[model samples]
Target: MTRRSTGATTMPPAPTIPKIPPAEVLGRLAALQTLPTPALKEMWRQLFGREPLIFNRPYLQSRLAYRIQELAYGGLKPETRARLEALGEQLDGGNVVLRRIRADSRPLPGTRLVREYDGIQHVVTVRADDFEFEGRPYRSLSAIARHITGTRWNGWTFFGLKGRPEA
Candidate 1:
């Protein structure tokens, strides 16, 4: 410490942080199990060019490392992204109303639902617009279930297509 012109004690400015190469940063990120939260946040800012929405340690480290490697190497192509999105949409039934209404019980066409009741096997094939059972076309599975069980039953539940009744 030294005396300033005003006769007050002063200290030198903090040293600047050196910029590390992306490759080195990636290597460190790979090797380190944990990093300081502040450092991780800073890396997130540098790699993403924006502040992260999450501050969880593992999430921050993983996302920061991925961004660093992605920048140093390359990111997914537009075609790949589009393909992934299409696949997601297909899994989602390609429509919000269908997804919400059908839930997990909507099997793709050509799928088969097999069940055994009273020592007899039952097979139901999913069709594009209807279902096929015993060489006959049926519109609703509930009708098939009612015919088979001789009582009212939820077709999806009877065929194990649904886990629980929808609210």
Candidate 2:
């Protein structure tokens, strides 16, 4: 075709959408699923104040869920991350994690604490002499601390409020 005096342009063809390999898709799902659902759910609640679930109303919720999950799994938050570091100083080789608030306040079952350290937050639950959620075994809080942070804690406690530790 010959060039015209007008500045009109032709539209480009639509971009093709590539299908994801089933193996790759399954691999990612497996990794995410490796972590306990309760822990993942707790992380979601702390970060987004909601459960880690794929919403399917209009498909928008699933998108949000993926974003939330991505943030939680990336790394610890700066606020809580520092706290975890400070716990080491106070405990002198003891693990000091930020404990969650309360049982009912907990986001899910089998979740003990949602502590923040070093600008990062973690949702953890431990039953004495048993293994932690991710297979980290602990005989005591100190052991749990070591297993979780590889250090000590000076300001570690269970989740509670001003009037209730068991609340």
Candidate 3:
């Protein structure tokens, strides 16, 4: 009898590459927004193999992260890693989510509007309880900002941590 034959052909899956840390991913999201053309996104896919994770979109955060792991970070340049780390601080400042462990509400607990006051970017911090600017009564900085600038900015405006003026 002829030798028994079994037909089977298979190729191995691609090697599992490391995931791009979420912080770096956020930095990429922020950096891509700075670009003006689609070319940047194309370059990103070619370099990193997927799109960046940006919130406020139709998809859930979990799904976005899963996709990032499934597709991105295969052949990314090591140089881009450092650049993204720096960018994360700039874009994702809201990453400062910690339990309440503070003594004084330094600079008051409110939004700090970055405005050009006296030819300089002066930070105006406000609190909801007793917010006043030059004898003008306002509820929050958001109110004053809207009154003066006529636009809404991100509400989570923070100057720095408690007692860290230089920060």
Name the candidate that leads on TM-score.
Answer: 1
Give the range of the ten consecutive residues with the poorest summed lDDT in model 3. 97-106
lDDT of 3 by residue, 17-136 (tens): 355675577665555545544545444445444664443333333444444544454445578877876665554453533111221232434655466633645465555454555557
Q: List the global CA lDDT of all models.
A: 0.76, 0.47, 0.48
User: Model 2, range 1-167, lDDT digits (tens) per residue?
Assistant: 99677876788865432333444544544445455555555444554655546533323334434544454354467988899778655533443332333222223335476666566675557443342535555544445455557766421452222333222
lDDT of 3 at 95: 59
RMSDs, each prediction? 11.3, 19.6, 13.7
TM for candidate 3 is 0.24
Q: In candidate 1, which residue pairs clash?
A: none
In the range 1-167, model 1's lDDT, one tens digit per residue, is 99558776687765443445665865676653566788888867766667889999888877766766676657799999999779767866577776665555567778999989899999999887788999999887888898899999888888987764422
Best by lDDT: 1
